[model samples]
Target: MCIKEGLRLHSPVAAISRETTQDFDLGDRIAPEGTMVIMNIWMYHHMEKIWGPDHMEFKPERFSKENIDKMDHFQYVPFSAGPRNCIGQNFATNEEKIVLSKLLRNFTFRLDPDHKS
Candidate 1:
């Protein structure tokens, strides 16, 4: 039995645009005034240092108990961290699970010439 990669790829939000309502200090880092900050999700995920040597590989074993717990929660963030993270992130998870289950039950998948799974 085999499984096509899941959660190995990420499509980051093109921009991180948000409005500030109040003044707050994030530890030593300070965000002042009505600042509009933008972050590139793809760049962060693809960085060699953050994801390690085989960051580009689709290795499900990366999510194993020992490794998962050891990883930096703040850095391996497909979904940006904090209160302004993502509203629909939960829905995406549920949807992925359902799709995976259905795929598992219905057919055998392979990396064929017709289509790339």
Candidate 2:
């Protein structure tokens, strides 16, 4: 849950662009094939309507089993989604967990007041 929250708040890739393979309907209009679609993953992750008013805050509980179902499956895409997603995504996540576990087991971490993000 913590890792998922971290990814939600800070997705590695900010945006992605793809060329349309066919005419896509947008309800009011149609984007013909060959058009370039730019998806802003960062902006999508911070949507108030989907994530609530406190969207920007770091709250890991948002991914708790009880609350997780409230979200759309596609809303969280730190590695992008579908078949074209990063092949190393699973490996990377497992590696993160292992590294994080070792680090937490070995050290204590605290925010530095002098450093402002």
Candidate 3:
């Protein structure tokens, strides 16, 4: 949950581009076939409508089982979505969990008292 929230707040990939396989209807406009489409992942992740008024805030519980059902699968795509989604997403997530677990078990983190903002 924490990892997913972190990814949502600060996605590593800024955007993704895909060329339309067919003529696509964009509601307000129509993108003809073979047109390149770029999705602004960061902007999508921070939308107030999809993520609620607290979209900008980090709240992992939003991804909790109960609340997760209310969300659109495509809305949060830190690793992108659909058929062209990241191939290494599963490996990457598992690696992140292992690394975080190891770090927590081996280290203690604290802010420096002598450091000034």
Candidate 4:
């Protein structure tokens, strides 16, 4: 849950560009063939409508089994999507978990003395 939430909040690939294979209609907009499309993942990650008012807050429980089913699969796509999705996503997520576990077990962290909330 924490891993998924972290990915949602800080997607490694915040934006991606794709060339249209064919002309497409996107509701209010139209894209001719060969058009370049830029997907802003970071913005989607923080959209209140999709993620709710606390989208910007780090709440790992949001990915809990009970809550996860309510969200759209594409709503938290840190690795982009479709055939072009990151190939290293699984490895990277696992690496993060291992590193985080080691860090938490070996050290303690606190806010800096001069830091302001």
Best by TM-score: 4
> Per-residue lDDT for 19-115 in model 3, tens only?
9989999999999999999999999999888888999898999889998888887888998899889999999999999999999999998989999
Q: Kindly state the number of residue pairs that clash in model 1.
A: 0
Candidate 1 global lDDT: 0.65
Candidate 2 residue runs with Cα over 4 Å from true position: 111-117
- Mind giving the per-residue lDDT tens digits that candidate 2 earns over 1-117? 999888889887788788999999979999999999988988999999888899999999999988878878788998889888878889988998999999999999999999977
For model 1, name the residue pairs that clash: none
Best by lDDT: 3
Misplaced by over 4 Å in model 4 are: 110-115
Segments of candidate 1 deviating more than 4 angstroms: 1-8, 18-33, 113-117
Instruction: Give the winner by TM-score: 1 or 4.
Output: 4
TM-scores, all models, native as reference = 0.69, 0.86, 0.87, 0.88
Model 3 segments more than 4 A misplaced: 110-117
Higher-lDDT candidate of 1 and 2: 2
lDDT of 4 by residue, 44-104 (tens): 8999998889889999999899888887767778998888899998999889999999999
* Candidate 4 colliding pairs: none
